[model samples]
Target: MASSATTGNPMPPSLSMPPSQFARLQPHAYLRAHLSPPSSDQPSVRANGRATSQFRVTSVNTGSLTHANGSAVVRIGDTTAVCGVRAELLHTSDISSWGVSQAPSKQNPTNTNEAKDSKSEDEDDQGQIQDLNLLVPNLSLSTGCAPGLTPGAPPSALAQSLSHQILSLLHTTNLVRADDLRIWYQPPNFDSEEFHNPGEGMEVDTEQSGGPEREIKAFWVLYIDIMILSMAGNAFDAAWASVLAALRDTKLPNAWWDDDNETILCSDDFAEAHRLTLRGLPIASSFCCFEGDAAAGWRANVIPDAEEQKKKKGSQQKWILADPDGYEEGLTQERACVVVDKENGKTIIVKMEKHGGWNVDSDDLRKLVDVSSQRWDDLKQALEQC
Candidate 1:
């Protein structure tokens, strides 16, 4: 949420507070807008105090994808993503030198199956498999975030950025094990007539055994597609929470498949299929920064309003707000998102949302990490059900 004044008062120092308290406020001076007003769920004191540091409500539902090996739907505050992981059979005719398999013979039925399995697998694994990986992410802001759209409209920048971030995060973190994504290497990467090690090295034609043998390999690809059901700010954190939570509850079942080419030749009802194994869960946190006061957030445009509006020239600002709310987010300078993997014991500052916001110091980053670690238990318990 927006980082600014830790008070319930909406007025800024320039408008009401004395100059002496101004400097003391530092960044907090500009975050009044992020402070929630008194409400039934939150008492006035709790509304703008420690509770602000706390996250919005979060919920996770698993087994969302009937076809996917493992799937989850997570909703945190305003962010949500539906993550599904599917494992298919892969066949590889050209076995790596380090592969454990011994040379196959015509009498080997398993070898024969491998050859045919990979051949039967689909070649368009790239595109078809990718779509299966689409999962909702923390930053996903649905088209509904925009108050106006006459249908047949373009996606908002926020939505685009969210997709890129989610995919990049999963890719970089190796959340989906590429090796586990075994495609049945049926036809293999070649044909019988194709020459191998032609002249220079005097190659070998392994497929000459009437037909090439296929090898099956395991691969795990994660699809993270999130639809924004609401825009409660903190999309990054919300997405991260749901992803980790749902993954914990995910299961892979026994299913039929050809290991070669790593393609799903057919589908097996989940009841009888083996589920994907989840190693651990990773979470992300976001901080918002701004230049002017928090009150100016909506006016200047830092966060997405219930009604989306263009940001003011304030995209570039002098100061930074930490974890801004919708109001403070609009006025705040920029945002920083950090993801932490508890199982792997790693923390990554994903990207600096340098939208004219102030730069964060190492000390501030350390503080956020500490916060994420300490709160791990609570978040962990909340997601364990998923």
Candidate 2:
């Protein structure tokens, strides 16, 4: 008979699990054990060693990419995002021609007449269809950004969802004005003597001659693209920050209609460029809910009943954590993101999103808002410095 050691009995090794599995199993406990301070007097810390309700250090850099009209790179803790803006000339006539045509003038008419009216309506509708997409936004996430993302494949659901959210915010917040993008056309100077004998070696000096009433012939379209370089957590916040920085740094060049070429001409002079007028700086903050024993310390502070607490000690306890990372995020059951813009000395909640099954109390929500307001101030100052 072989000895016990040589019997080939497989024994479960001490710490024989993958790092990901280790992170998944009792994630909160792992954080509290490794990240929190040994002293009981100190509060429990997150995986990144940040106190509860505190965000990680954030940084931003603007106008870094020369190819893009505007560009910015934002880093919040481990999450990083880059945003770029490209400007393209779009004719106003084309956009206005896309609107829906008016209904037929006559409700009831002969078949031939109705057919004629339908054809006319079709033509009018085609002429009236307006292109409402003035600002286009897209987000890209690839394999290197995170673990599950694949390379060169279709964008994941998370990327598509983030893109939609950004589009919604840009449209609803009124961040960019329509008039700022308009390019006015300087009409020809028919009164000038140069127009009398145009074929006889006479050239029309359009730049020097005072023309008729000017009208908007075209507008500049801004295409905003965001790429996620790294995603630890809170991608929405990082993406929004990058967009704000890039847009703030954008400058549109002076554009004019060229009647001779039948195209819009943009001035090469840098001095002729104009900056966008932003309504206000908007910032976002995100939070996650940590339930069970992970929140015992917080629950103790909130509920000051020794006997009641003892009775419910075995019950689940809940706490809110700000700026959670990937490991903590996996264990969290609920999340909330709030966007605030300061306007005229008052804080406005421009957008708010909540997900997951956990229900937050009114008091807890109020606390989250206060934290978000503070975070907005921090982010706004950082952006200004950039």
Candidate 3:
């Protein structure tokens, strides 16, 4: 071979790898290198250039769908989700388990205890909603939202799991009020003075008044559909945000039971529509614990005694990242979700879910709640703008 050194081709620029390629090939090591700096002077930062406890900015838009009773679009960083709520009337006659006894009949009893009995029957409003299956929520990922999500296939495990979580939160929080869904019918002259004061020189016939003066004839079933337009990461938070915004924007028409037709009817006046009265604005925040690679240069100490090992365990280098992106999610295994509601300037934890790793402890949970509270304020402000 000819002597190329003499020709001065000059070592063709020492080949270098890009940071993006390095992150893809060695995600764990790449993250560890950033979090565990070579010197104490260097600040620890994530590969995405976000602080460990910082979350992405959230933006929301509501009432985007005219056909849907309520609709909202939420974007958290690069991830985006659209939620739509449709209400359908479910007549009591259609429910096989519904019976006449469940409905309170008009009575002429002249005691306060009798009125208490009638009120007690309707106390379990949430129970009625659950028993009748009034709320239905479904989540689906778009085909191109992420890699490996193909079209025309059955729902993936992630989708199913997310849907289940959403449904569980909805039920646990009791966000929807049953009074907003219930449709009642009052017979003619039922609210007359005779009913208000039965013994005030007035006679009432139970047969003439038909059955119950006021009875629930139907309930509104809210079908909440959430679609992931783009899934960068932290799907649960984005999905929940969309759901909350959509429900806030949802309006149901004035509905009543028709006596002659014996069916639920909706009013045509737009002014008669009313928005849903949700219990509280609950917000969801997600985080992941990124444990440094075992073989990384940060952990070069020799194995110690049992007591020393126990002491060193607490000093392990791990980073708890808030609102991790897709790349960070793949590098981490430990994750947690905190759902919180703010009441009177106090943060109330509605639900807390932690799994996939044991690095998170009680103290860590408290920190997570603090971060969630801040995130809640940010998201709440965003929703309010819509």
Quantify all predictions' global Cα lDDT against the true fold. 0.50, 0.77, 0.84
Tens-place lDDT digits, model 1, residues 12-48: 5465775446535643443443343446475222222
lDDT of 3 by residue, 91-131 (tens): 88888867743745322223435444423434465577677
The alpha-carbon lDDT assigned to residue 355 of candidate 2 equals 83
What is the per-residue lDDT of model 2 for residues 1-386, given as tens digits with 9 covering 90 to 100? 87657988876577677655766776667665654458868776766667889898999999999998899999998899999999888785676442233222321222434365444543432232223577889998846888977667787889999999888788656677665776766577888776787667677665456445456677678899999899998888899899999999999998888889988888899999998877578787889887656554456568788437556555555658898877778777688888788877688888877887444667787788889888988998899999
Residue 244 error, candidate 1, Å: 3.5
Model 3 lowest lDDT segment of ten: 103-112
> What is the full ranking by TM-score, best candidate first?
3, 2, 1
* Top-scoring candidate (TM-score): 3
What are the TM-scores, per candidate, against the unseen true structure?
0.55, 0.73, 0.85
Choose 1 or 3, whichever is better by TM-score: 3
Model 3 spans > 4 angstroms off: 1-10, 13-15, 38-42, 100-123, 189-211, 294-315
Model 1 regions lying over 4 Å from their true place: 1-52, 64-69, 78-143, 146-150, 183-214, 217-222, 245-272, 290-323, 343-355
